[model samples]
Target: MPEKPPAIESFKESTKSPESELSPEVLEKVMNKVQDINEAGVAYSFVSGGPYSAGSIFEQDNLQKTKLVRILKEGLLGTPEKFYLEGVPPTKEQWAKEAQVSLRKGGRSNVYFNVTGMAHEEETPNTQSGETWISKSAGSSKKNALAFIFDLSKFTYDDDTNKMSRKYYETYYKRSTRKFTTAYGFNLSHRVPPRFFNGILLKLQDNYQYDQLAAEIGILSEQVYKEKGNLLLPIYDVYGNLYWPKKMSYEEVKKFVEERDKNKE
Candidate 1:
């Protein structure tokens, strides 16, 4: 482990608000649920930003960085995997369509999956400039491996109003208040297999602003967990190294997260 960064240290101090600011009952309930899941023998892993048009793990804002650290302290284990997309940016409509498909399939579809390969440069006639147009082919063939994919459409400000289903909060949290203000949403991408699934630590941008920690922490209570019975929470470290069940057992990973938290304290 490396030294905790100064920005994260500042974040820790700043987040120490009085508990009375929020509903203590709700806070305690969320904490209890989190404790129960942590002891339920569920496996855990970390996933940073996945295939986004903007921002990488290393370039995350303070809020995002703080959220990653806070979740790690809460007990998620392993190095965080950093995912990125290649080629031209997709339109908002395209992303919305993909989100619908991802929700329907309960994971990422193969349409978004990218295989490792090299970029091929090519030139063509430019009608406007009367010069050769240069561009690189999106597909590659150097190496064949799985790259993590997530629905970026949900994260954009345009989708903030209608994208996040209020039914989730109404059913799980039992609160009608729209806790999430920003368009940001969080979840495990389709990259993780079904067998090793545990749970997800979901958070939106305005989630922290409203200090809706309980709603954010209540992801395990979702219906998907009931159906799957195995959903691993994806986490990310400051260094952005990805970890999964293939590299460590659930017990080992859990212990690692707990120990790391203790040391930080």
Candidate 2:
């Protein structure tokens, strides 16, 4: 027999909604609405010369200080004069500083949390590890964590069914994308809160090349919640080993950890 679905109690405190006490049948209704949604591109960061290679974890002596960094900080955190950043936002500055340090010997790698909101035109084609991704977003369209939060807020869910309409998704895309534009502030009311996204962003800040891990956890968490009205596993898994974030499986994770430990020994 397969593993049973995980319980929702683990994630309920984080979700912080009365709606979280949803029945499996109701949660399934919500899953049907969101199952097909996906993002189009990968997120990344540039080191001293260019993009970091895969599996080569290292620390830099200084922040990369690219345009994407500035834009993300400003877009999500807001200007000091306008509004102070509330809740647990990702410490991009600190994250950059730490990522610049030498972690392990080099091979090939990717960043955990990439510059989220970048226009399709801003990215270069045929890019590879260690090569620079040109960011011409002097004034370009981009989606930050804030934009996603705002998008989630727009669509109201039915109290009983817990689902939204296709028309809402169409509007969300319209608001999230545009040429030479940036999303600044949209007063968030309810639905998914900022802390939810902040948790993911902060987690992303710590790892190297785990965007899929975050994405998968978010999707799976929601799917499981809807199907069983609970979480199936901790995002980091029971052993505190991050297999999915590295895009691996349980057996593969066991082998990888054993090999790593054997090498260390």
Candidate 3:
């Protein structure tokens, strides 16, 4: 027999609207409609040397960010101002909290809460500003974790399903990139190019290289949510360990992510 899909509840309280399910693929015209949907580029801006990098687990490099740029290219373009940011490195706690409500909402809360602490020093860093955010929560890096930039203008909404789809891709991407850009303010978003974005995802799939076909499906699942509300996943017959954001211990998260690639027999 096969393992069942993992059921997850969203951290936030609000209910996402119900959506009609989509098939494994979309028609040609629908593809064309969303083809020119977003700005063409990666969301990265340079820091001191070039694109600041964080080590990745889900990907070899930061390919998830590239997928993000593509999603937002269509959605965040020409939207109203969510908020305005001042610089590359957003101001610390006191001011960031004062700026916007959502900015500090998802930040590191407790040592156990932190999901970004798994990286080696090379994969994660918080040196300066202007590139991406590596802001850890108040104290001990265990619970209060996750690195993100402090900008507001980068967020946008849409009548089309791109926002939801992009968000889904970004959700997977954040697990690896952890590299959040701050500018407009809502959350992770930016405007760059396709090559860098493509390069990142390609590098990730090339690097760790999972055996399942989820990577190919990931691109399409991302697009499907753009059209319909529901998503389907290819549950490979692999059982590793288990992890929960708040429910499980650190050991659990490690096991949970590992499960996707661990079982093969």
**Per-model TM against the reference:** 0.24, 0.25, 0.20
Tens digit per residue, CA lDDT, model 3, 125-193? 332311111222121122111121111223243334333223211222332444322221122322221
Candidate scoring better on TM-score of 2 and 3: 2
Ten-residue segment with the worst summed lDDT in candidate 1?
133-142
Of candidates 2 and 1, the better by lDDT: 2
Show where candidate 1 strays beyond 4 Å: 1-17, 36-40, 49-83, 86-96, 99-265
Instruction: Identify the superior model by TM-score, candidate 1 or candidate 3.
Output: 1
Residue-level lDDT tens digits of model 1 in 1-265:
1121112222233433333333454334322222112221122222333342112222435333343333333322111121123322223344446556555654332222111111112322222331111001121111111122222222222233234342211111122222221112122222233332233322222212212332232232232334432233332211111122111223344455577557658
Q: What lDDT would each prediction earn against the true structure?
A: 0.26, 0.27, 0.24
TM-score, candidate 1, is 0.24
In model 2, the runs with Cα more than 4 Å from the true position are 1-38, 41-120, 123-177, 180-188, 193-265
Q: Is candidate 1 or candidate 3 better by lDDT?
A: 1
The worst-scoring run of ten residues by lDDT in candidate 2 lies at: 138-147
